[model samples]
Target: MPSSDDVYSQLKDCVSEITKIPRGEITLNDSLSGDYGYKDGPSRRSFAISLERCFKKHGMTIPKKLDRDKMEEAKKLKNVRDIVFTAFGV
Candidate 1:
């Protein structure tokens, strides 16, 4: 498994590049729609596309059925560290 730090770094880099959100502005608590100005929510198709791109860039597989339910879980994530840890099944 990848280290938590590695995962966090990957997620931070992915989210920043995909969302076009500034590094300083990106935070775990920020909502995709409310905080990130993604009115459609973080689980929206567009966000998924960006996530898919990230996975592709890392030579990772795009998870299927990453819908609202999964997105909600993802949104509840507290930080890039959490996201990376969970994503790698750590």
Candidate 2:
């Protein structure tokens, strides 16, 4: 199993791809929109879908509850770390 740090790294990489922000410049606490350019609900929703795929690609499984439509469930994940923790545990 991958460690939490590895998971975080994967997530960071994905966000970097989407936002073009350097991974080193992003912190786990940075909000998806406020900080990293996921500026709206649709984008966040898309991100959630991409995240599900990302986890799958890495042989991980994101719980269904955390992956909800329109980002309803994921909205509470106000930052990168919160998303990872909610998906994989902290």
Using Cα atoms with residue i matched to residue i, what is each candidate's TM-score against the true structure? 0.63, 0.63
Top candidate (lDDT): 2
Candidate 1 stretches greater than 4 Å from native: 41-45, 60-68, 72-85
lDDT of 2 by residue, 3-72 (tens): 7777777777766766788878866567665674667777777777777777777677765544444363
Clashes of each: 1, 0
lDDT, candidates in the order shown? 0.58, 0.64
lDDT of 1 by residue, 1-90 (tens): 556566656667777887687777666677666665555445445665676678668975433423544454444335434433555666
Query: Given candidate 2, what's the lDDT at residue 67?
Result: 47
User: After best superposition, candidate 1 residue 53: deviation in angstroms?
Assistant: 2.1
TM-score for candidate 2, residues paired by index? 0.63
**How far out, in Å, is residue 34 in model 2?**
2.9
The weakest ten consecutive residues by lDDT in model 2 span 72-81
